[model samples]
Target: MKRVYNFNAGPAALPKQVLHRAQEELLDFQDTGMSVMELSHRSKEYEKVHQKAATLLQELLQIPNDYEILFMQGGASLQFSAIPLNFLPSDKTANYSLSGSWSEKALKEAQKIGSTHTSSTAKETGYSTIPSQLTLSTDAAYLHITSNNTIFGTQWWEFPSTPSYIPLIADMSSDILSRTINVEDFSLIYAGAQKNLGPSGVTVVIIKKELLEQCPSNIPTMLNYQTHAKNKSLYNTPPTFSIYMLSLVLDWVAEQGGIEAMERINKEKAELLYETIDQSEGFYIGHAEKDARSHMNVTFNLPSEELTSNFLIQAKEEGFVGLGGHRMVGGCRASIYNAVPLESCQALADFMKSFQAKNR
Candidate 1:
């Protein structure tokens, strides 16, 4: 069966090779006579899959042994509360740079749990760019930032410089493994597996071991990072199938020359799409500023709302799904995650030019 050029944000495209390997392992994972889905989390077969995934992830991200990688449920959203619950006492405050909707939501969740402050926010600019000229508080419990804003199509090219004492927490849900990152920079990093990893059932949390000591014992057991870290992410029944699929995806990533290769191709793919929009003159307009543009999700708009609607219809006809921006900001968006092939971006760019030529 032919596959459409997938651009859906989360639960997005995974590598074709990974899919094939999963298919092969479905009936018998290492000749266990059972699918990984059917394997018990405690079983030796599943344990190996889980451990290998962790090891591959550590190698891919260059995560030091000081960091504890926990695969838990509840997506990255749950971490919004979990983060504040663990660190932010009601009397103290946590600082955030509100760059996009996700960070805004994270700030709100933190407020509900305890006091929170925004070092900076780009809401006044319609979230079109990352906020600059920030004032950060070193005394705050932690400084939270969304690494990439999927909806707004802006990304923090480089993190703001903060004191070593201030723990930097990042919501890397959308752009986690799409590029190479200095993992040591963060005190905590969390991402949903759906985007750059595998499916939606699991959320990966990487926390420096020292931060776990900061978590108060009053918080819920499941929300505490120390709980899962101590138990090796087996505190309860884990998302076995999702972790297995994630292992396969990591294997594909390593085989494809690791994250550096992914970054090179991802940069090229994004540039091709953005360059198409740039060359369109007045016909197509990009949403984010050039300096803050995101490589994973590209947002653009045609000359008119009518043309934007028409563009979606045409893109669909050309086997491009999930091009519609989002309900909040109605325009056009293309989420070109790691698994999105450069050929797909090229095809979409061609479609855009053709549509512009005919309509302009």
Candidate 2:
């Protein structure tokens, strides 16, 4: 079987080993006579799969004992509202740094729930750069930041500091497990699994125990972080198949080494593509500045719209998929998520070089 170089931003490529493992167990999971997708989340067999995924995630992240790992639904977008509903107290302001499209949406959702302060913004740059520093208020309930801007292809090398006592929340959907992070630096972190984790149906949340304890009451049971924490993310069925796949993916990651190892490989992959763009000598123009370039998604443009169109068409003919950019901006994007092999990146870089040579 052949596989194309897959660079879709979300609902993206998954590790082939994870896919194969799922295929092997799809008919009978752990000697059970039922598929994992068909099992009741309450079943003992399914529970093992569910718990193992959480355990692997905890081990991989080296998450602090004080943080509660949750597997929730409704994607990270749901957390946009749920976060404010649970943590943004009526008397306090939620501080936000307007970094990109997702953060803008999160800020908009928070504005509807309670008072919000825009501490900093990069709107002037079309969301191509992150704010170097932010001015968060001590009275703020939570300071929210999007660690990686998926659409604009920019990311924070380091987060801006907030007031010491204030909780720092981040929507790290695109870059969740792509690197090593000091989990303690965040009071809460949420990510949609489609990018780096597993699949679209699962959303992973890591929240400080104190923060979960502080989650306000009267919010809908499903929308409340405390409810999920109390229920161990089994308040409802949870995504059994997706969690199973995530467990396999985590195993693959561990086999490759831990997050530091993943980060190193990701760095190498990103540099290959970025170097291709930079060396194109005006044949390609990158959307983000060098320092802010994302290690996951690399966005750029060809010399002309026609060349861009032909490049995509040719790339597809050569077995590349999802090389197009987000709709908000019309360009090219190559999302080199963890599942994408370094050899694939090398091939793409080679393709880019050849494409430029023939066209130029």
Candidate 3:
């Protein structure tokens, strides 16, 4: 079978070795005569898996001792409501920075529950660049920002410096684990595991312990951060299979030299593809500004929509998948997540060069 390079935005490519390891342990995990999915989440065996996944993540990200990593269901979208429900009261307002579609959705959800003020909006710029400065409300519950805008292909090169009293909350679903970061900088960081961690169905929430104390007790027990933190993310049956897969992926990440090494490779891959687009003359046009371009998702357009369609069709024939852009933005998006090897980037770059040479 031909090895196709997958670039799906979510439910994206995972390391080949992780897949092979899972295949080996599919039927019986660690001499146990049952698949991991077949095992009960409450069982000691599964407990070890859960703990290890969280531990490795803490170590890799250097998550502060005060932070608790909670693996819960209902992707980052759920967090949009949950964050506000848990932290913001009907009377208090939270500050949000709208950089892309996801952040906008999050802001809307916050508005549904309570008042949410916008510190900055990139809508005026067509989401092509990150906001230079944000005027946040000093009394707001927290300042929310989407660290990486996947669809718009922009990223916050550096987080805005906010007042120490107001905690910063970040939606890092698309770019989590792609680079080394100071986890202490944010009060809460949430990501859907599909992009850089593992698969969908599980969202990882890293929150400082003090944040948990601030969660309102009046909210539903299930949505309460304290509940999940107290229960150790086994509040319900949990996304056992997804969590198990995430454990394997986190293990793979550690073996690959942790986030620092991943950062190096990610930089190389993104630079190679961006350089190709920039040097393509009028043939390829990048969507985001050079400084704000995302290392995980690269959005670009061809000279014409017709050419874009033709390029995608040819790309599939050449073993490239998921090069199509989000429907909201009509263009091409190359999501080179952590698992997408550098060689795959080279393949796509070579294809772009050849296609541009023929069409331009």
Candidate 4:
């Protein structure tokens, strides 16, 4: 089968080994007569797959024992509402850092729930930079930040500090498992599986036990973090096929030497593309500042709109895909996620150089 170099932002490229493994077991999983999709969620076979995925995640991230990993539906967007409904008490304010499109959406959702504050924003820079200094409040219930901004191609290389009493939370949907992080730094973390984890159907949440317990009981049962934590993320039918795929992806990550190794490779991939843009000498203009550049998604613009369109057309002809940017911001973006091989990045970089030589 011929596969083009995939660079789609979400529901992005997955490790080929993981896909192959799934294909091998799609007809019969673990000697069971049925596929994993057909297995009962409550059955021993499926539960083992579920638990193993969680375990591998914990091992890879080296997550603290106090954190609960809950695999839920609705992606990270659902958590935007669920987070405030569960943790934002009536008396406390939920402070958010408005970095890019996703953070803006999260902040908007929180505003509907209760008292909310924008501690910082990069709007003045057209969302091309992450806020260096945040206006945190001690009275805040929690400080929410999007660790990586996919649309603008920026990331928090160094996370912000908050008041000790205020919980620090992050939406790490695009960068989770792509790097090494101190799990103890954030009180809670949530990610949609579409990016670095596995597929689009499952969302993984890691909440400190204390924080999970503090979620008020009056919220809707499905929206409550406590319910999922208490029931081990099986309060209802979980996404079985997605979780199984996640397990295979996690296994592939381990075989590649866990988060640190992944981070190193990701940095190398990002640097190659960024270097290509930098060396283009005004042929390409990057969106984010150097310090805030994301290792996963690299966004840049050509000298003109016509040149950008021509670059994309030729890139596609040469078997490259997903080089277009998000709709909100029209440019070019190359999402080099964990599953993206360095060889693919190298090929793209070579293509970029060749394209510039011809077009310039």
What TM-score goes with each of the models? Answer: 0.99, 0.98, 0.99, 0.99
Instruction: Let me know the TM-score candidate 1 reaches against the reference structure.
Output: 0.99
Per residue, candidate 4 scores C-alpha lDDT tens digits across 1-360 of 899999999999999999999999999999998899999999999999999999999999989899999999999999999999998988989999988999999999999999998999999999889986788766799999999999999999899977667889999999999999998899999999999999999999999999977878788999999999999999999999999999999999999999989999999999999999999998989999998999999999998999999999999999999999999899899999999999999999999999999989
Best by lDDT: 4
Misplaced by over 4 Å in model 4 are none
Error of 2 at 156 (Å): 0.6
lDDT of 4: 0.94
Q: Encode model 1's per-residue lDDT on 227-252: one tens digit a residue.
A: 99999999999999999999999999
Estimate the lDDT of model 1: 0.92
Of 1 and 4, which scores higher on lDDT?
4
| Candidate 3 wrong stretches, greater than 4 Å | none
Return the lDDT, model 1, position 84. 95
How far off is model 4, as Cα RMSD? Answer: 0.7
